[model samples]
Target chain A: MSMGRRLPVYLLLDTSGSMSGEPIEAVRQGIKALLSDLMSEPTARETVYLSVITFSSSAQQIVPLTELMSFQEPSLDANGSTAFGDALKVLEQCMDREVVKATSTTQKGDWKPLVFIMTDGQPTDSWESVADHIKQKKLGNVIACAAGPGADENMLKKVTELVVKLNSLQPEALKAFFKWVSDSIKTTSQSVAQVAADTPIGLPKPDPNNMIIVL
Target chain B: MNTEKATLKDGRTIEFVHDQPRSGTMKEVYFTPDRKSVVCFYKDPCAGSDANRLQRLQMILGAYNPTLPQSHGGAAQNDIEADYYRKLFCWPTGIVVQPRFGLVTPAYPSNFFFPTGPVWLKGEEKNGMWFIGPKNRKWFEKNQPSELGSLIQHFSLCLQIARAVARLHNAGLAHSDLSHNNVLIDPSKGMSIIIDIDSLVVEGLFPPDVLGTKGYIAPEVLSTIQLDLKDPKRKNPNARTDQHALAAFFYWYLLGRHPLDGRRIPPGNTAEEQDLLAFGSQAIFCEHPSDSSNRPEEKQYVPCSALGPLLYDLFIRAFVKSLHSPSDRPTALEWVRGFVKTWDLLIPCSNSSCLHKWFVFHNSTDIRCPFCGTRFKGTIPFLKLRAESRPGQWAMDGQLAVYNQLPIFKWHIYSRVFPSPETDRTRQAYCVFHEGKWFLVNEKLTSLTSPGGNRVPPGQAVELKDGAQIRFSQEHNGRIAEVQMIRS
Candidate 1:
């Protein structure tokens, strides 16, 4: 039997000081729920490879790209300043190293990765240059979510055009965000991610009360 | 733990779970009190506001519905016929008009779900993807081998899907979104059921709401996917496209790989662009006779030819000839007929430990199991069935590779009856090897005549020897069977 190409998904979370206590616990729960949900789906489990990169004082790739069956929930903690710029740099490195590209010799390659960035506070580091490079290069379908009021939508907008916002860092809102992420990944696996290379992803509509899409 | 009431357009009331319901792409699903049925409400507020959707649902539950008898304004002729179709489809039963645009559908049969397994797998619906896709199949092949059924069982799964699609096409309807997500299969018992009936495409009236799933989408439809919905060049889902999906499903079920998902990479800088070209405009069959560039990279694979000549011809017609030409594609009825004929050619493998316990007996001279490469070492009997085409001329109709207790049915004895929903399925006779000699005992045939022209009555048998012939029936369109014994 021919094994299929992988659909790599990278989750970048902000473990800044503001995202402590209840907010951090909710993020842990969300990761747990997302893993179980993706594992149960046959197509998602077959092609979806997941990784996690967290940034507090500095960014670190907590989990390497792994299939759903073998993926473990990484231990998360909240402290220090938000190094959003460092996180983006780490994500770029991991994607370049892990994502496979189709060439003349190799017929099969990984799908363009789906990247989700969740942050509740502003970056305390210089991030403008890396953000412009990532956006101009069109690395992947990067969806940046401005979590809570402390997060600036415009600053995150500089990173990717596809942006959504959560009104609060409450556990319920974070859970809903993760649920939506799972649904989006499921839809991509089950359908053509985008009709063309540059079109917006055909994602399922989210709950209006908890989440808002910044068009 | 709250409950709510929903009123249907027909003045019936149903209660459902009131809390945050489980939602799908387009609908929010709620379970009824006893869990016998589910009430699904369309998420878009405009869906129920429009009258067209109401009319479409009415048509689906009424004249076009196969799960209901004609007396109830459905397509089926009688109760028994309707009963048979009920097992094949989870047809919507009612329309919910009060709460929102919704449908009431029966819960899937229990067998469509995994009864017990790992916590992640238990109680989950047996979507066709779980059993057919390469990665998931690998998991089953390693951890739970019982879920992966034998080769014959997979064939029967394809046959049932063909039969179900034939019924829909017979009524001039098409399941626009026919994919693994909408079709559930239980390979253990050789059963399949099609869900999501509300998305059916009705000609000149209701258009399809969805384009279709990724891998199952027809080439023409995907090629024109970027076109505007109202554009004339945009090809929508129809019966022909459904034929493409039906064939793809059959290929996946039998071969354990996709037919068109090959190694040929198209020109595109991004994955999405490459996919659009590879699966749409530049689609190529992996097993194309002349084009070997798109061949699967797997070191070992069971070629489509392993399924035998009858099915191989259909596969070629489906993937190679009509991949881009929708009109030239093999119809669902054609697939049904092909599988019915192929069913007679099936024989159990001699290898006791073979993963595929049954295989098509393609060649008697080179009797071998394609899966395990085991050759048979004994005498085998074959009954070549013929039908009278002229006054005294008998034409070759089909051949049955005989095995112990292989029962013959009405379709075998009578030439007019092709196995369908309304066909009589009673067994007419059976074959058995007694004392090292093959005998086809007469069980229900009233006019079973031996090669010597003597009537072999019920409870009597005729020895199937070399050059022996038997007339299955003396009535109009009766078939004659010529026995050939081959020793390997």
Candidate 2:
């Protein structure tokens, strides 16, 4: 089969000390659920390439851009203070190195990446400069999720216009969040051709009882 | 599992599993306790509030339905006719008003689901995407070859799809969103069934529920998609759009590639903008006769012309002349006719290990299988059919390639008896090969005559010699078959 254009998806997760115990385990199950959901979808498996960036005292790309069929769930542990700035920097570097740009000569490039960020605590690192750069450049369809009351919605709003909030860091809430994320990606990949320029791809509404969209 | 009962609009009660419902963009579906039907409630809170939508559902479940007999308030005439069409579509049965605005539809036939496979694929709905999409095809070829049928079976499934669409069009209806997601096909059994029948466009009764799915949306619809939904200039999903989608689907099934997706990049900065133009305003047939710019860079790609002249002409009209001009596109009935004619031209591949297993006997001196590049050997016979244009003048109608044990139908014996849901499918005659010679045995034909003007009664055989003309029937519009032999 001829290689087709890709839809890159980035998951930036805050593995701060605040995200231990139930929260950490839920995130692990969430990633597992996401992988299985995407792999089972024909369209997503064909077009979506996934990557994971974890941030604690430092940020690292636990999984580089990889096809859905070949994607491996990474082991996640929560420990250090949230390094939100470092995570954003790592996401930027990965997008720069991975996302293919359309050229007049070659085949069509990869679609604009979809970045999902989840955090349960306030950033311990200086993130304003990088967040402003991402906002000004319109880097991608960046959606930041404030996983608990401790996370700052204002800070997330500064990073990306699209923000959602979970009232609690319960395992059930995290599971629902990830399921919704998987559904969004599946829908995006399935109807990628129908979305026009400038219009953000529509995502399935999350369970209102568990999550809320932050305007 | 716990179950909940919901009252239908017709004062009937149906119980559904009260477990986590499987969600679609617009609805959440729950299986009935018996698992024979599904109750799908629209997620939109306003859906139940819209009286117009409820009325449309009533019309869909009653008057316009093709899968039920007229006695059941459906369009089909009788139970037999209804049963025949019932296999072609999964039509909505009733409206659920108590719980919410929803529909009751029969669960898809078991064959539409994967019986067994890798854990993730087991019991998954067999969407046409798995068969037509190149990447999915590769996955099936590697993971489960049994899931993929031969090329001839694919053609049979396409014919079934054409027949299903024709039935809808005949009733002045349009499958608004005719795409992979809305249709399920069982190529291994040469079967196809259209689902989501509730969304059908019923000609002036109600508007289309959706524009269409990506890759299957009509070029005109996609090109004008930027317009407001109610804008007069915006083309919506109608019968003509269904025709375009049907053509695209047929091409994909036969050629294993999309008709419009090629390497050409439209002028746009964002991927969405580029796709909008690529599949819409700037769309080009990848195999355009005069334009090589958009042709796919695939090695060993079998061109659409390999499908034989009838289908080749249809493909040209579909993608070249009518890609944007909706009115000029071939109708669903026309596709059925094309497939019917092409069905007679199929021949089994000589290579035992050929992936396609069969290939169309195209009109060329070099006969070969396109998939395996296997050359056919030995002599083959063709029956050039002719109908009486005048009192005694014979006009060429069509031809059928002969193979051992090929059963001839009424359509082959009588030029006027075209195959359809209501047509007789019993064999009228049959062909056989014995001792290096071919013979045509009369089965049900009462007035069968040999090339030598001798009566060939039922159960008797006539030698099919080169240049021999056999009269299949003496009745009006009966066909005469002239034999032609070719050595490869």
What is the model-wide C-alpha lDDT for candidate 1? 0.88
Model 1 sits at a Cα RMSD from the real structure of 1.7
Docking category for candidate 2?
Answer: medium
How do the residues A70-120 of candidate 2 rate in per-residue lDDT, one tens digit apiece? 888899989989899999999899998988875535667787789999999
Listed per candidate, the RMSD to the true structure in angstroms reads 1.7, 1.7
Please provide, for model 2 over B384-408, each residue's C-alpha lDDT reduced to its tens digit, 9 standing for 90 to 100: 9999989989998988999888899
Q: What is the fnat score of candidate 2?
A: 0.45
List DockQ for all candidates.
0.55, 0.52
The superposed Cα distance between candidate 2 and the true structure at residue B356, in angstroms, equals: 1.4
Q: Estimate, for each residue in B239-356, the C-alpha lDDT of model 1 and write its tens digit.
A: 9999999998898778878888887778877667777777888988999999987887687888988888989999999999999999999998899888889889888898988878
Model 1 interface CAPRI class? medium
Worst 10 residues of 2 chain B by lDDT: B292-301
Q: Model 1, range A1-215, lDDT digits (tens) per residue?
A: 12457788999999989999999999999999998888889889888999999999999999999988899899999999999999999999999999887553565667778999999998999999999999998887899999999999999999999899999999999999999999999987776546456667778787688899998
Q: List runs of model 1 lying over 4 Å from the truth.
A: A1-3, A193-195
How close to the true structure is residue B407 of candidate 2, measured as C-alpha lDDT? 90
